[model samples]
Structures are given as structure tokens and as C-alpha cells.
Target: MARKPKLAVWKFSSCDGCQLSLLDCEDELLALAGNIEIANFLEASREVIKGPYDLSLVEGSITTPHDLKRIQEVRKISKFLVTIGACATAGGIQALRNFQSVSDFISIVYATPEYISTLEQSTAISSHVKVDFELHGCPINKEQLVEVISAFLFHRKPNIPAHSVCMECKLAGNVCILVSNGVACLGPVTHAGCGALCPSYNRGCFGCYGAKENTNTSSLSNKLYQLGVKNQDIQKLFRSYNAYTPAFLKESKAHD
Candidate 1:
């Protein structure tokens, strides 16, 4: 029998939601386990197999000096490295600190600020290493996560969409919340995922999936301004889960 392809999952500074998304794939995970050797997933199993892993799924942002060094080693050992979720791809909600003073925040939050050792800014994995692929989302869509892993296993491109949430809203036959309700939605510029869940229920999109490819965030922000959305509110919307992503970060700064 052929040796099973080794798989490893790593975490840095995150809520561990993305790792849980894999475990949530209860049935598909069982089938996947049959084909791959889950070499090092601390959340799933404490029994760690040694690396030079065939594929590695990395979660979270690089927020510390230790994380910066460790990710370089992870890249050296993994043949293919895929970053998952907003944290891995765009630095996540923690990236909000990038706009402010880290030292001031640390002094306020920590009992002993001197004891905490961290980078001034939270940054994505790709900012530090060569990422083979990026799966974007706050927690990620499980179906998409499975497709990404399977694509690497089969040596093919993952079939994830690059469209905005507006496409999903149209496909689902939901009314345009921005147009009809005069709501401030990030759907026009945000990536497609979460099945347009918020808009389906008459709520505006929160942009948890990050900015879509070739997003026109300025156009969308202008539309929000036209709809009577306050400038500060517009800035806050763009500075959410995927705040540190280039397109969203730039747009948020425009509002500032």
C-alpha cells in the first residue's frame, strides 16, 4: 500500500474556530481520515506525528515574535501550506490594533504590560511565508475547507468562488437590502461565502468573509454614504473581521 499523505494543522493567535470547522466535518472527516494521515492536529489529537508534512493547514495570524519564527519553520517542513480563515489570510479582528498604539492598549489591558511580548501589529501568514493558497472567512465555510484539502490531495485548484456576496444574494432570490431597506451592507464588496445568510433574513452583510477579488470598496462606501450611513459607521463596518486585508484597510482609512 502507498504511504498516506501526511496532514498537519497549526494555530497561532486566534479563537480556534477554523480548526473546529474541520472537526465539524464529522462524516466527511471520517472518510478523509481513511485516506490521509492526520500527523499533527493538537485540537483533535495529542498524539503528534513528526513533520515534513505533505500538506499543512495553518490557522490564525502572526501576532508575536515567536509566531514569526515558528511560521518560517512550518514553511520549511510542509510541502504545501494553505492558510485558512480571516486570521490566517487577513490578520482578523485583532488587526484593528494596527491602526492604534499597541503599547497604550497593552498598558490598559494587561496587569503588567512589561511582561507581555508581542508584535506591534497582527499580520497574516502570507506576510511572513509563501502561502500556497488562502481560504478566507471569519470561521470559514466547512464545505469550502473540505474542497481546499481535497483539491491539494488530488493536485488540482480549489473550486472556491472569487465573487462578492451580492452574487450570492441574487442567486438566493433575496431582496437587495441596501437598495430597498436603505441599509449599509458590505455585500457589494465582501467575498462570497456564508450563503448570504444575513441578507436572506433581511439583515445587511457583516463582511466576515473578507474583501472579494477586485473589490470596489470606495464605490460601496459611497453608496452607503448616499444611504445616510454615517462616516464613522462605514469605517467601523470595513474594520471588522477581515479589517487588515488591503482593500478593506484602504477603504476604512478613506473614511477616517
Candidate 2:
């Protein structure tokens, strides 16, 4: 008999929203349970079996020395390692710490700053280990999460788009907010996945997903400046969610 493949999920410095996206699968998770042994998922099950896991879904950034060591161990055990969400793929909102001193941040946030143990920068898992795939988002879209896992289960590439959110906005028959309403938006450079949700509601994209491939943040920043968006706001715009992603980071610094 062919034994079921074992699945493991790990978390580091993150909000755990991406892991919740797995639970949010609700129905798909039930069907998925039939095919694989969910060996280690603290959020879904506390009974952690030892691993040389077949597949591992790792969420969050490496924010501390402990996480750095832990992820290396994870890479050793998992045959296939897939990093999920902006935290794991590009570093989440916490990546803001990368721009400034961790000591300064800790002093402001903690009354007993001496007790806070952390690294100076927040970084993606791929920065530390060889990742097979990366699924990007602030809190990753559940459909995309399913697609990633299903692809792994079938030993095939996931059919996830590499296009910008602007493509999704056009597909939804929504007018370009930047063109129609004179709003500053990241849709032109942000990745497609959330189905252009914010733009559909007549709001600008906040780049919940990371930068799309071939993103032109310089051009987008110029457009925003033309729209009378403040340089500070423009900086803030790129410094949120997927802040540390190479494209966004470079553009954000250019504004400084």
C-alpha cells in the first residue's frame, strides 16, 4: 500500500493570518485530509509527529537567531518546502524594522526593552534556505493556498498568475481608479491574487500581495507624485505589507 504523504506547517515572525487561511479552507481542508497525513500543524492539531515530512508550508519571516536556526532544521526535514504569504516570501509588515534600528524599536514598544530578543532585520525564508516555491500575500488568498498545495500533491506546477493586479481589475470590468478617480494606486505594480478586491470597492490597492514580476515602481511613484500624493505617503505606501520586497524597497528608498 502506498502510504499517504506527510504534511507539516511552520510559523515564525508573523500574524498567523496565513495559517488561518488554511483553516479557512473549511471544505477543501476536509477533502485534503483524506489524501495526506497532516503531521505537524499547531494551529490545526497539537499532536506533532517527528518529521522527514513530504511537504512543508512555512509562513513568516526570520526575525530572530532562533528562527534562523529553526528554518534550517525545517529545510533539512521537508522534501518540498513552500513559503506562504508576504512574511515568508518577502517579509511582512514587520519588515518595517529593517529600515531602522531594532534597539530603537524595542525601546519604544517594550517597557523592559532588555528582555526583547530579536535580530536587526526581518527577512524572507528564501534568504536563509532553498525554497521550492513561494506564495505571496499579507494574509494569503485561500484559493491560491489550495492551488499551491494541490500542485504539490500532484507533483505539478501551480497555475498561479504572475500578472499585476491591474489585470484583475480590468477582468472585473472595473475602471482604473488612478485614471477615473485620480487616485494613487499600486494595482499597476502589485501582484494579482486578491481578485482586485480594493479596486472593486473604488479604493486603491495597498499591495497586500507582493510586487508583480517586472514591476516598475519608479514609474508608479512618478504617477503618484503627479497625482499630488505626498512623498511621505508614497514612502508609506511602499513600506507596508510587502515592504522589504526588492522592488518596493528600492523604490521606497529612492523616494527618500
Candidate 3:
């Protein structure tokens, strides 16, 4: 029989939510296990199988010197590397510190700043290594995660959408909160994945899935300003879950 493709899941400096998304795949995971060799997943199993893994699903951003070295090693051993969630793909919520002084925060938050050895900024995996694919979301949509793994297994592109959350809102028949209630929303430029969850309930999107392809954040920001959203509030809006992503980061900086 042919050897099952070796799969590995790695964590750097994230909440481990993305890894849990895989385990949450309960039924599909059981079927996946039958076909793939889960080589190294500390959260799922303590059994450390050796690599050169065929595919690696990586979570979290590079936040320390150790993270920098470890990711290079992981890349060297894995034939295909896919970054999962906001942390791994766009530096996550922690990337908010990229705008401020890390040393000052460390001195205030840590009793001993000298003991804390970290990089100046939290950065995505792609910032340090060649990433084959990037699955964006705060925790990631479990269905999308499965599709990404399956795509790799089958040697095809993942069928994830590059459309904006506004498309999802329209498809789900959710009323436009921005137009009707003059609410400040990021849905116009944010990626579609969470099924427009917030807007479906009459709330605005927080952009947990990062920016969509060719996002016109400038136009969206102008619209928010017209809706009475203050410049500072607009800045904070873009600097939430996927702040460090280029599209959102540039827009956030413009408002600053």
C-alpha cells in the first residue's frame, strides 16, 4: 500500500484556537485520520512523529527570536506549508503593538522587562518564510480549514472565496446596517467567511477574516466618515483582528 501523506500542525504565538478548529472537525477529522498520517500535533497527541512532513498547517505569528528560528526549521522540513488564522497569516490582534513602543509596554506589563525577550513587532509567517497558502480568519471557519487540507491532499487550489463580506450579507438577505442605520461597518472591505454573522443580527462586521482581494478601504473609510464615524474610531476599526494585514494596516495608518 502507498504511504499516507504525512501531516503536521504547528503553533508559534497564537491562542491555539485554529488548531482546535481542526479537532472540532470531529466526523470529518475521523475520516481524514484514516487517509493521512498526523505526524506531529501536540494539542491532539503527545506522540511526536518525525518529519519531513508532506503538508504542514501552521498557526500564529512570529513574536520572538525563538519563533523566528523555529519557523525556519519547520519550513525546511515541510514540503508544503499553509498558514492558518489571523495570527499566522496577518499577525492577529497582538499586531496592534506594532504601532506602539514594545519596550514601554513590556516595562509596564511585565514586572521585569529584562526577562522578556521578544521581537519588536508581531509578524505573519509569510513575513519570515515562503507560505504555500494562507487561511484567514480570527479562529478560522472549520469548513474552510477542511477544504484547505483536502485541497493540499488532492493537489488542487482551495475553494475559499476572495469576495467581500458585503456579498455574504446580500446573499443572506441581511439589511444594510451602514445604509439604513448609518452604522460604522467594515463589511464593505473585509473578507467573506463568517457568513456575515454580525450583520445578520443587525450589527457591523469587525473584520475578523482580514481584507478581501482588491479592497477599496479608502472608499469605505470615506463612507464611514459620512455616517458620522470619527477619524479615530475609523482608525480603530481597521486596527482590530487583522490589523497587520497590508490593506487594513495602510488604511489604519492613513486615519492616524
Candidate 3 TM-score, C-alpha based: 0.97
Clashing pairs in 2: none
Candidate 2 lDDT by residue in tens digits, 29-65:
8888988889999998889989999999999999998
Candidate 3 colliding pairs: none
The TM-score of candidate 1 is: 0.98
lDDT of 3 by residue, 40-149 (tens): 99999999899999999999999999999999999999999999999999999999999999999999999878999999999999999999999999989999999988
Q: How close is every model to the real structure, measured as TM-score?
A: 0.98, 0.97, 0.97
For each candidate, the alpha-carbon lDDT, in order, equals 0.93, 0.93, 0.94
Off by over 4 Å in 1: none
Residue 30 error, candidate 1, Å: 0.6
What tens digits encode model 1's per-residue C-alpha lDDT throughout 1-256?
8899999999999999999999999989988899899999999999999989999999999999999999999999999999999999999999999999999999999998899999999999999999999998988999999999889878899999989899999999988988898988889898997889899998899999999999999988888888888999999999999999999999999988
